[model samples]
Target: MSKIIQSFEAKELKKRPFIIKIADRLTSFFGSISFLILNLLFFVSWIIFNKFDQFPFPMLTMIVSLEAIFLTIIMLVSQQRQAHIATIREELDMQVNKYSEREITKVLNLLKIIAEKQDIKLDDKELDEMLNELELGYIERKLEEQLSEKQKLIIDLSPLNKS
Candidate 1:
C-alpha cells in the first residue's frame, strides 16, 4: 500500500493511550461470537448445577446485567476512539484527493497546450467547456443539503410519524 494509506492506519494504532488499547481489545473480545458461546455455556452450567427456579434466574440476570454494563463502557470507549480515527482518515483522504485533483488539472492544461501547438482541430464539446476546480467546501455543503433532504423524506415516510 501507499505511504498515505499506511499512515492512515498506523497513526491510529500507534501513539494510542494504554487505556484505549485495553478497551479496544476488550471490546473486540466481547463483541465476538466466542463471547456469545461462552455466555451460553455459563448459563447452561448455572442452570444445570443450581437449584434456582429456571423461569426467573435472578442471580444470572444480575450477573448478565453487570457484565453488559461493563461491556457497554468498554465498547463505547473503543467506538469513540474509532470515530476519532475515522475523522483523521477522512481528512487525510480529502487532502490526498485535493492534491490529486490539482495534479490532474495541471496535466489537462499541459495536454491542452500540446493540442494547441499541434494545431489539432478537436470538435469535442467537453474540451471546449472549462474544467471546474475541485471545491471541498462546495461539495461538503451540497452533500449536507442532500443528506438533510433524504433524512426529512425518511422521517415523513416513517410509520412512527403517523402517531
Candidate 2:
C-alpha cells in the first residue's frame, strides 16, 4: 500500500512541474466564462442527440494518448536530471573521502611506530628501506586480491507483462 502511494506521489510530483503549471495558467487565461460556455455547448449537443457510448471511451482514449506522449517527455527529462545529480554527488563524495595516499602513509607510519616501541631504533635510511619493503609487499598482496565483488550497474526499465 505504501509502495503504491509512493509511486503515485512520485508520478504526481514529476507531472506537477509540467501539467499543474499548465493547468493553472489555462484556468487564469480563460476564466469561468469560457468554462461555462464549453459546458453550455456540451449540454446543447447532448440534448440534440445521444452520443455513441455512455462512458465516452473514445474520448478517454484520445486523452490518454495525448497524456502518454507528454508524460514520456517529462519522464525523460526527470531521468536525465536525476542522473546528472547522481554524478555530481559521486564526485563530491570522492573529494570528501579521498584516502589512497593517506592510507598508504598511515600504514607506513604505524609500522615505524611499532618498530620504535620494540626498541629497534633505525636511522632515516633504514626506516626508508623498511617502508619501501612493506609498501611493495602490501601492493603485491593487494593486487592479487583486487577482485571486485560489485556487479555492473544496470539501467533497464520495462514492463514485466511484455512478451
Candidate 3:
C-alpha cells in the first residue's frame, strides 16, 4: 500500500492520452514483425501439412478453425482496446481544462457568448463542427504543452542535459 501510494505521488507514469495508449497497443500487436512471422509460419505449416500422402484433412480443418477463432479473438481485443481509447477521448473532449465542472461549463458558456458577440452566423451543423474542432485543438495543445514539460524535466535529470 505504501509503495503504491509512493508510486502515485512520484507520478512516474507517462502522461499520455488514452487514445495514444490504444494506438500504441494496437500497433504493437498487429503491426509487429512477429505477427507477420507467425502468420507466415502458420500458412506454410498448413500448406506443407496438407501436402502429405495421408493428409488428415478433417484434422487440418479443425486446426485451421481453431486458428481462425484465436485470430478473431486477437482482432477483437485490439478493436476493443482502440474503441476504449476512442471512448476515453470522447469523454475527455467533454471534460478537460480548468479541472472543475463549473469552470468547464463556464468556458463552454463563454464560447457561446463570444460567438454571439461576434455574430458568427453559422448553421447548427457548422457550429457543432467548429466547436468540436476547437475543443479537439485545445486538447491537442494541452497535450503538446504537457509533453514539452515532461521532456524538459527528463532533460534536467540527465547529466548532459541542455535546455
Candidate 4:
C-alpha cells in the first residue's frame, strides 16, 4: 500500500472515538471467513445438542434475530465512519489536484516566456490553452450539464417511461 494511504488510515484511526474503534474491530471480525466458520459451527452445535421439543427452535431463532439486529447496527456505524473518511480523502485529493493544476499552468507560462527570450519559436495552440489558468467552477458546471443531459436521455429511453 501507498505510504500516503497508510498515513491517512493511521491518522483517521487515531482520531476515532473508542466506541468507533471497537465497532471497526467488530466489523473486521464479522466480515472474516473465520467468523463465518465459527457461526456455522455454533449453529450446528446448537441444533445437534439442544433437545428442544419445538420443531423450529424458537430460542435459537430469537437469538439469531437479536444478533442480526446488533450486527446490522454495528455494520452501519462502521460504514458511516468509512463514508466520512472517504469524503475527507476526496476533498484532500481535490485540493492537491487544484494546486497541481495552478502550478503546472504557471510553469507552462514561464516556459513560454523563456522560449520567447531565447528566440525559439514554438507554435502549439494546445500549449497556449494549457498556459491559461483553468476556471474550475466553469468546468464543473459544464460537466454537470453534460451529465444531466445524459441522465435525461436515459430516462426518456427507459421502457418504464413509455405509456
**Who wins the lDDT comparison?**
4
lDDT of each residue in 70-101, candidate 2, tens digit only = 65665555565556556755665554444555
Which 10-residue span in candidate 4 carries the lowest summed lDDT? 47-56
Instruction: Estimate the lDDT of model 1.
Output: 0.84
Question: Could you tell me how far off, in angstroms, the CA of residue 90 lies in candidate 4 after the best superposition?
Answer: 0.9
Candidate 2: residue 144 Cα off by (Å): 16
* CA RMSD of all predictions: 2.2, 13.7, 18.8, 2.7
TM-score, structure 3 vs. true: 0.36
lDDT of 3: 0.64
lDDT of 1 by residue, 1-163 (tens): 2787788678769888999999988888888999999989998999888886465888888998999899889999999988988898888777887888888877877887888899986677675443456677888999999999999999999999998
lDDT string for model 4 (42-126, tens) is: 9999988888725588999999999999999999999999999999888888888899999999999999999999999999999
* Model 4, residue 80: C-alpha shift (Å): 0.9
Query: Candidate 4: what lDDT?
Result: 0.93
Which of the predicted structures, 3 or 4, would earn the higher TM-score when compared with the native? 4
In order, candidate lDDTs are 0.84, 0.58, 0.64, 0.93
